[model samples]
Target chain A: MKIYIPNSAFLGNIDPFLRGFDPSDPGTLEITANEKWIAVHPAVLSMITALGLTVKPENISCRKLEARSRHYLVRMGLFRTLGISSDISIMEHEPAGRFIPITRIRTSEELSNFKNEMIPLLHLEPEQSRTIGYIVSELAWNVLEHSGSEHGAVLCAQYYKKSNSIRIGIADTGIGIRASINNSYSAETDLEALRLALKPGITGTTRREGGTEQNAGAGLFFIKSIAGINRDFFVIYSGDALYKLLKSPAARPRLHADPFDDRHSRAEGLPRWSGTVVGADITLDQTAGFSALLDAIRVTYRDAVRERLKARYRKPRFI
Target chain B: MRTIRLVEKTGAFAENKDVARALRVDELMPALERGEEVALDFTGVDAATQSFVHALISEALRRFGGGVLDRLLFKSCNEPVRKIIGIVTEYMQEGLAPGE
Candidate 1:
């Protein structure tokens, strides 16, 4: 396996970075980066850490990074997470209101603890904290419950000062969406599985309308709606398919049951990611009230269930 | 009626599904089964995830039918918590089988 860290890889232009990932040799991992500067979204680091964990420490090799901004990687704990030594020296500063380093959560307890500690570190407003907390909880829980990855979920976040937004990335080298959703639904392609996974009342655990008592199958939909209502970018990649909800231009963006129905872009036959990677950008400046967002969710969720039920309704026989 | 203080089980933010499940399987379900009304008091909880709310009440609705809502009381819920619970109940009812 091999990956190259480019100069810029935020959610908007992360496609080439993802496309460059080579998952050919699972036994060995090579990480190389540009020599000038290295700046990327938390999702990029999370993906590298997730992929690195799949190989033996001795088998993983990283080229000496000469980028002037190489310390950002060190600060983000990328090399430390992968168990490699970058041999770069830099002054350490307080991380408050800046970023969350690469952290691996393997249990529910860890996730709960992380959430408790995450808010203060970001120094966000009460409403903003709730939104971030909600996203991390839902995304990480999906990994813990369904990913089936031994290493669990790797996640990190950064508060972008310029955009006044929080960028988050979560990756897991476990069963991809196709495998998980196929447990109950017959989705033939990875993209189809993603479509079902995003829809309300659908889960890999069961085909029933309400899902199992534990999972309402509404987590992803809620997260997507949050991003849509805020007019931010949200991306999900599993196998060779990727769905990106493009940033909306409307003052009030409408939520869609089908992810493809939103202003979005997709790619098929890309380099396959064995697990799943999700990246979300939440612009705090324009965040909608959490309660107001729920009002919309309630309407869309009920409508989605009604549509599915109507689709299954039998037609009367003609005389 | 037996009242369960949720903040004691889950802190201000109730996102942990395990605690919700325990309260459901251990406390809520047993009390509902014994013909006692259960009031889930969220006196100090600020917010809750949809998953946690579903884990806590969706099963009771499934087993006892929608009538369970009549016996279950949500107390001291803030706006966000109330909305989350409302969403869960609405969707569960929408998905329930006919006559359930």
Candidate 2:
């Protein structure tokens, strides 16, 4: 496998970066970055780390990074995670109020601990902490409960001081959404599986209206709604399909049960990612009150379930 | 009525579903089966995930029906926690079978 890190790749223009990935050879990985500079979303790091884990560290090879900001990768714990030596030297400053170095979470206890430590590192207000913490919890838990990856979830986050927003990336090299959703429902394509996975009350675990006691299938919907309400970008990629929720207007936002209903873009037949990758941007400046967001979620969730049930209602046929 | 202090089990932010499941299967369900009312006291918890709330109570609602809510009480919940619990209960009931 080969991946090229371009000079700039965020949620907005990450498509080219993803399209550049080469998944032909699973036995080894070659990582190359643009010479001058490298700036990417946390999701990019997570994807690289997840792919690197599939093979032995010896099989992974990285080009000598000459980017002026190459130390950013070291600071983010990239080479350390893949067990490779970047040979880049830099002073390791405190991570507080800046970023969360790449971390691996394999168990529920690790995730709980990570949540407790994550909020304080960002130095956010109580409200902002709750929002960020909520996103991390739901996204990581989805990986733990459903991904079926032996290595679990690899994730990282960065606080963009310029935009006053937090960008998060999570990836796992497990069964993709199509396989997971197919456990209970039939989705013909990876894109269809992603659509079903994003809808409320739908889970790979069960087909019932309310999911199994453990999973309500509401995690992804809630995360997407948070991004939608904040008018930020949220992207999910599994298999060869990518669904991105574009930024909304500054006016009051309406949550949608169908992800495709939102202002979004999609791609099919891209480089196939065996696992799932999600990138979400939460612009703190536009964050709505968590309670108010919940109010909207309550109404939207109930209506989504009602609509699904209504769709199943039998019609009297008189011919 | 048996009151369970959630802060002792979940800390300030209650996002762990394992603890919720334990409280449900080991404490909440047993108490309900014995005909005792259970009050889930969230004196210090500020927020909770929907999955945690769902794991804690969805099974009881599924097994004993929506009327089980009458015997369950959520005490001292902050706004977000309260809203999460409300969402869980609302959806469970909305999706419950007529006789389930």
Candidate 3:
């Protein structure tokens, strides 16, 4: 038996091959490129294998894979990191920066190792590397806390020296933003859920569920605030909704949420991402003071939260 | 005065468990009880998240109240880490509010 996905089955395709895959059936997973150009995200294969599917890159065969973008190389690196063989020599090449190999962070040891390995690649000072490590840890931890994906999460990173930016991409094939937020609050759409998730102190966990101690719903909000440290951008995709938080120097940052756009358009009509993918483009400014930047964002977030709470409770703000 | 260096116990990747092990509130309680000031030196630490900061400090705040913050000193925190510590402190303080 064999399972194959042809063409550019990117992130938007979600689980193109796992709709009704039988666990009992012994089948080989194959990804064949029918077109001259093909692009695949790291999450696609990581999530599939995490869900009990035994698809190793060595076991899987690829045919006529061509690169239209660096994405092709990154995807190949992702598979190669999983001990799969490919035509591309990721070790010898550095297109933008090296891909940290799409990996599943399940245990504390694994997560720590991933962070340690990724930081040195940034080649920043001790203080600068730690800051990025902290941000990555919080985002990856969200997969364990919120996603509830049986397969854990898929994470890959790339640093573009020309752009002076580092991009960390993390995806999880779990109950998405809507399902997670809807667990406690009434979120009807993915966009609404994402919006609510961005709000500080808003979490899907309830009171009896040990919510406050485990989380204060401040992770993503902090990520959003800090990504603008040197005017970086943050983007999140889940379900049919795509969210982008853009940073500007002259004006305040803006968040645009669109239910229609998934950053990819398929003429054959693929499915929306069933999970969550967060891509953060952080501009590398070694001289910038993160403490001062954090203080500013802290004041802004506190004021916003205070104002919202004041309106909701109709009482004096006491903080 | 006892200075607890974070990097000594945990490497660059500091998590909630790492913080817990680094600063055992139960063990530190005796020091606080003995009127010894505890300074958390985050000099070699790469980065720390809100969760890691909150885990140990929140417990101390709950056990010793706002007075603990005075005895508890955070030193050598870089801009990014200092910011996270500040956020966690503020959040824990908010949780101490009346009927919050």
Best by DockQ: 2
User: In candidate 3, what are the lDDT values of residues A50-112, reduced to their tens digit?
Assistant: 332234455555554565453554443545554545565444454545455567776667787
Q: lDDT of model 2 at residue A264? A: 93
User: Which regions in candidate 2 have their CA more than 4 angstroms from the true location?
Assistant: A92-97
DockQ of each: 0.88, 0.90, 0.40
Question: For residues B1-100, could you state the per-residue lDDT of candidate 2 as single tens digits?
Answer: 9998899889888989999999998999999999899999999999899999999999989988899999999999988999999999999999987899
Q: Which residue runs of candidate 3 sit more than 4 Å off their true CA positions?
A: A1-63, A68-76, A81-97, A126-128, A207-211, A247-272, A285-288, A312-319, B1-5, B16-18, B21-43, B62-65, B75-79
lDDT of 3 at A42: 43
lDDT per residue, candidate 1, A1-319, as tens digits? Answer: 9999999999899999989999998999999999999999999999999999999889999999999989888888888998888899877563434888889999999998899886568889999999999999999999999999999999999999989999999999999999999999899999998899999889999999998989989999999999999999999999999999999999999888988899999898888999999999999999999999999999999999999999999999999
Return the interface RMSD of the candidates, in order shown, one decimal each.
0.6, 0.7, 3.6
- RMSD each, Å: 1.1, 1.2, 6.3
Which ten-residue region of model 1 chain A has the weakest summed lDDT? Answer: A90-99
Ranking by DockQ: 2, 1, 3
Q: Candidate 3 chain B: worst 10 consecutive residues by lDDT?
A: B91-100
Model 2, position A35, has a per-residue lDDT of 100
Best candidate, lDDT? 2
TM-score of decoy 2: 0.98
- Comparing 1 with 2 on lDDT, the higher-scoring candidate is 2
